[model samples]
Target: MQEARYTLDDLLTLMQVLRDPQQGCPWDVAQHWDSIVPHTIEEAHEVADAIERRAFDELPGELGDLLFQIVYYAQFGREEGRFDFHDIVHVLTAKMITRHPHVFPDGHLGSRRQGVAAVDVDTSAVGQRWEARKVNERDSRAATSHLDDIPLALPALSRASKLSSRASRAGFDWPDHRGALDKIREELAELEVEIEAGHQENMNAELGDLLFAVVNLARHLEVDPEQALRGTGQRFERRFRHVEDAVRESGHPIEHTDLDTLECHWQEAKRIERGQ
Candidate 1:
């Protein structure tokens, strides 16, 4: 027989009980905002990983883990007398409706545009309106620049992408991808010079500049730098695993393997990937 399903209230109640002082789980009672941030980020990444891997069966569990992070925050807010999960829902729903005025004509939950198909909506106009609304919201929050409010806690590559995107929106961007491509070559040359000079500090700064240039090129090419890097990492791991397996079959330690042999295996991995 199937068990009864738990609802949102059940989840909220569970969080409250787990966080209750004296009777609650010790770890849950001890947790605070700062300490939970890492767990929240990890859960979010796990959810993303599940989606990217097309693990639909695991998605529900992953999504529940991510939702629990929000519930934890909401529980903290309730304990502090500031807000709760309901408030979060209200703010998110209202903001989304306001931003998508074409769909929500009256900016209310029950309101919808009549007789207009989504395909017939002016997408460019919608985008402009959305940006205008966001700018107004930012200004009301006392933001001093278009770059304001980007979270400092974001991963470096993702943050760099956001910083460059904001700059592009402010008309500081190159005219096309060619300009961004040229920038990569320029940064590469500077990095090479720094390497030759053997100044560790200069090399580090130049390396960062080179990476930022590559990220800009990625933006121009309509690629996400973080996701692209993740994909590359996956490819590297897969091919390296193949190398390890081949080495094990030959009874050779990978440490003692020469570059020529390693390169041969790497090339074979590439060939297999290309179906050659």
Candidate 2:
């Protein structure tokens, strides 16, 4: 006999059992939505990390962990009589169907029944339509500003990119990447001035402005600033580990290594990384 494959209903049932007050795992039973928020965020980042690292073998497990976070939230909502997994699924499915007019029957691009091939559809127009639909959704919610729905809990870089995109949609953005690059230079100058003044508070604010300007530049170049920064951090770790290994081979602790010697090791690490 073939082994049975568990369906979404079975997953929901598993979550329900895990959250049962009398017989569930204590940790699972004790978790509320708020308590799981950090884990949810972490699982999301882990999924991203797996993709960034091209760890295809780990992708399924990472994705499952992220899905479990959603399941956990749905279970909490079910307990409170607010919503459930099916409600979440329903809303998501409806939203996708509503968003894809080129593919959906009621969409602007006509329907599959009209014999429109996906390859023949104008993707740029589809993207514009998607954005317009999102704006409509925002309006329906009575959002006071274009940026009103941006999540405050987003990572600073991601949030900055989103905020910039929202403002751009309102015609408040730079005309081009050149303008963004100039703004970055201007911000850097302001930061330099603050640094020279030796005022910690002003320096802090100026530095934040500088970083935000760089994020704007990244946006103009169509780069996800959060992902770019994460990639840079990974590269730094890899290079630093190479330096550490070099130091260990030299029989000296890193702290005792001279700056020039460490710099040499770093250069070597870069050369090696570049296949030089």
Point to the candidate with the largest TM-score. 1
Error of 1 at 53 (Å): 1.5
In model 2, the clashing pairs are 101-107
Kindly give the number of clashing pairs for every candidate. Answer: 0, 1
The alpha-carbon RMSD values of the candidates against the true structure, listed in the order shown, are 1.3, 2.1
Model 2: how far is 54 from its true place, Å? 2.4
**Residue 123, candidate 2: C-alpha displacement in angstroms:** 1.9
lDDT of 1 by residue, 6-57 (tens): 9999999999999989789999999999999999999999999999999999
Which candidate number has the best lDDT? 1
Model 2 worst lDDT window (10 residues) = 105-114
Cα lDDT for residue 61, model 1? 98
